[model samples]
Target: MSKHKKAAPQQRQEMSGVERLGLRVSSMINHPIAQTQRWVVIHRLDTDGEAEWEEVIGLLAETPELDLTFNDDGAVTVRWERSALQERDDFIIDEDNEVETEVAAPF
Candidate 1:
């Protein structure tokens, strides 16, 4: 047998902007400073563009885990609704998890 190790399968891919933002939000909530934080700040870079921001916010709004509010300075504040999140624990979408999509191959 050859002494070379086999290449690992390409299982991991780069995270999208929204996915990264989601992870950040999760981290903030779990952080110790979250105890007194009333608002979770999100800058433009978090979403890349206005359209991307809209899309990210739109997706989060659909879930009951968190609430998002826009600030005058163009930052987004995130509010976690623990009860709602607990209830949706069975299907919570977080940074570490990937949303599944099925695509049919074009013949």
Candidate 2:
């Protein structure tokens, strides 16, 4: 049998403006739903030299069932159904407080 080894982890690529923004927003909540409708927590760096958390809700193109609420304080909360099959598998999306702080901070 031929021997095979696992490949090393690749370095993260530099994010574009939109990606940066998305990444920032994704790191400030807990248990974000993935593309498969599974909940996952997103982690990222913050301005205060700390880690932050966030959540993301995956949405299907054919089925549209997501809503967003934005507060005056720059905070956002999103509510959406987890799966089309479930009667009530909704989730809330919150702002990545850490990322927001990071973006606002003077680099």
Candidate 3:
């Protein structure tokens, strides 16, 4: 008889503290509100997350999709721009079928 083993090593695996902090950082920077509260994000990173500062910097630098931008106001924000998310001139249903869109812009 064969020995029984765990079904999945990664199934429902708990994230490490670093992973959790990374998630929080991602959410804060990616949120629409972050654009207006850039300083708040920086302040939190400086004070609350000071210990993990190096890890945070590594995450931002190592991530090819994430970009660190320094604003004129002295606040920094991270942004990710997926190539697939770029604006298309018209609506697309499928590879062969595209529907022209009438933009609501008055200009």
The backbone clash count of each candidate, in order, is 0, 7, 0
* Residue lDDT tens for model 2, 45-81: 3431211222232222223554545547534444444
lDDT preference between candidates 2 and 3, better one: 3
Global lDDT of model 1: 0.58
TM-score of 2: 0.32
RMSD of each: 13.4, 12.4, 10.5
Sort order, lDDT high to low: 1, 3, 2
The model with the greatest lDDT is 1
Q: lDDT per model, in order?
A: 0.58, 0.37, 0.47
What is the TM-score of each predicted model, taking all chains together?
A: 0.53, 0.32, 0.39
Candidate 1 lDDT, tens digit per residue, 1-107? 99999998878889887677666655655543342332356666633756667777777677666678888988777777544554555433344332243432111
lDDT of 2 at 70: 50
lDDT of 3 by residue, 1-107 (tens): 77987576666878765676667665555444432322123323434355565576666667665577656764455654434223333211133222243432111
